[model samples]
Target: MFTIHAVDGYIETLYLAVYEDRVLLIDSGCRSDVPRIEEVMKRRLNRPMSQIALAVASHTHPDHAGGAPTLRKRHAIPVAAPKDINQWYAGFSGGLQHKIDIMLGHFVAWTLKYPFEMIYYKKHLLYDHPLKEGDRLPGFEDWQVIETPGHTSHDVVLYHAETQTLYAADVILKVGSGYRPPFPVSMKKEMRESIEKLRHLDVKHLLMAHGGPQQVTDFPAIVDAMLKEIDKGLPPGLKRFRKLERFSPVMKRYYRERRQAKKAS
Candidate 1:
């Protein structure tokens, strides 16, 4: 039997899919979350660090892809992520945005009343495998990847057909009885389209990075609710962060490239 344990990460909930022999991290947590993951696997799972065979980064954001490289270095665990995941933080703007993302991670922590901690990590992503949509996670074939862009230029959610669980990364967030699209909605149209794609899936459970895990009676209703929030755009308190993020070089370039791609397609 495969048991999925939700580890309390520094900022987000870390999902660890464990088996008798090996383990898989549904979404690698923040950089500072490295030690925490290690501890959980050792003490809770009673497995050595090497048992963590693969760590998948569902997106390039700080809380999603931050701890992957370090986990690989520390335990030689292979890192897998979406195609072009690195491009989101590729050039000069990416560098600045990366630092800004680190600060934002801290800012998010602050907003959540989380005590201070180091959230820094290398700006660039280093993954052993580049996963395209529909590619089964390198070793864990039971899980399949679904391209769900919009929260960023590149985002993906893993779906387990048998279990009907969608590991929605930053693509969806549930906070205090509410569900909404991730911050910065870097690509609003795409985000909605991505959510639309998810709406069609037979997902009975949503495993979110932020909202812990949840059971679903009406998944489409939840998706529709989130899509509505996306359409409504950022609320008053979030408008500033959205503006700041959109002003970043990364977002500017993402916008230009998306515009051109739309025109071409």
Candidate 2:
């Protein structure tokens, strides 16, 4: 049996699956997270850095993949990431509108929280192996990689049918008692389809990158809510505001405070 460790980071969580005196790291956190990750390895897992046989980046997002380059360079660990990561690694790709949307949402939000990390992401870090659906992760024979793109075109989720565990990555995020997609879903239709795929799975444990572990029972209602939103397309004004929320740190803080106040009330 492998032990799973959730290493908390600035705004992301890195998962480590340990088995047979070796570790498989999922999502390497940000640029500055290496030392903390090492600390977790030495103190918590009682393992050396060399025991990290393989590392997988759930997607190309900085929080998930920023430490990948360091892992590769320092530990010489092999990394498996989405093939399409190169498209957005350097910067944005696709149509002007698409680029603008992502820059306003994901890019701006990341920069607001981790400026130097963002710079490191764009300038450094080269993804190693390209993973896709049906690919079995090395050292984790039971866990099967499944494409779960929505947050990003390259997002993938890991499923272990024997254990009924789903390493959902950012596909399903825990919000209070329920789950939801992270803000500024770039491909709504694809995201919905991915959620539908997960809905059919006989998952008992739903593990996420951002939120820690969640109950599978909490997923159905969240999926239903997301499907309802997908059916009702975003209004132009609301879309604009969502993008603006990413760009303006003040707006983000205001919304956060407002939500907290509402919950308190």
Candidate 3:
């Protein structure tokens, strides 16, 4: 059996699944978090960087995929990512969206009163394995990857059926005692459908990128709460973040079509 270690990243909580001989990175954190991950492996775990067998990018977001290729280069770790991840930032518009996402990462840092740090990363990743729903993570077969595309079209979450624990990348966000959908619900309907898929899973522990891990009693209730928050949408005070989120091509087209449809009506 392996243990999970939490690495406090610049704007997210990164998880490392530690086995006796190898390690599995649940989600590759921001570019700025690479050294931090290496330090944790060396100092805390007392393990060589070579022990890191695989790094999984749940999505192509800066925080979720930025450090993956770096780890592969520095430690010879292979990255397992969504099959369509590279498409997120494929062209010129995608490149602009990538930069905007990075800026939003910094904006989140500023909102949390955290000090400045570099989080820039390349848009395209040299992924070794492309994952799909129900496929087990490469080199970490015990954990299963579930596609949960709402925050992003390529988002995924890992499920450990043995322990009923879920590594919910950015599917659900927590603040104090509350839970909410991620900032940019790029595909709202798909997000809801993805969350519904999760609701049917037998999950006892939930590990979140934004809020960290927590024990779940009634997983369905938690999911219901998250869905409610999504329905409520972002409040007026946080509307600026939504504006920034629209920079994504998917989000831009989503809103643009909505506006056009509203005007037609």
Number of the top TM-score candidate: 1
Query: What tens-digit string does per-residue lDDT give for candidate 3 at 65-90?
Result: 98987898888889999998887787
Which residue runs does candidate 2 get wrong by more than 4 Å? 90-119, 123-125, 229-265
Model 3 bad stretches (over 4 Å): 251-265
Please count the clashing residue pairs in each candidate, in the order shown. 0, 0, 0
- Selected candidate, larger TM-score, 1 vs 3: 1
Q: Which candidate should be chosen as best, given lDDT against the real structure? A: 3
For residue 80, model 3's alpha carbon misses the true position, in angstroms, by 0.9
lDDT of 1 at 246: 60
TM-score of each: 0.94, 0.77, 0.93
TM-score of candidate 2 against the unseen true structure = 0.77
Candidate 3 lDDT: 0.88
Provide the RMSD of all predictions against the true structure, rounded to 1 decimal: 2.2, 9.9, 2.1
lDDT of 2 by residue, 18-127 (tens): 88878888777776678878999999978899999888888765567777888889989888887766554342222333335434435544754754333144423476
Using TM-score as the measure, name the better of candidate 2 and candidate 3: 3
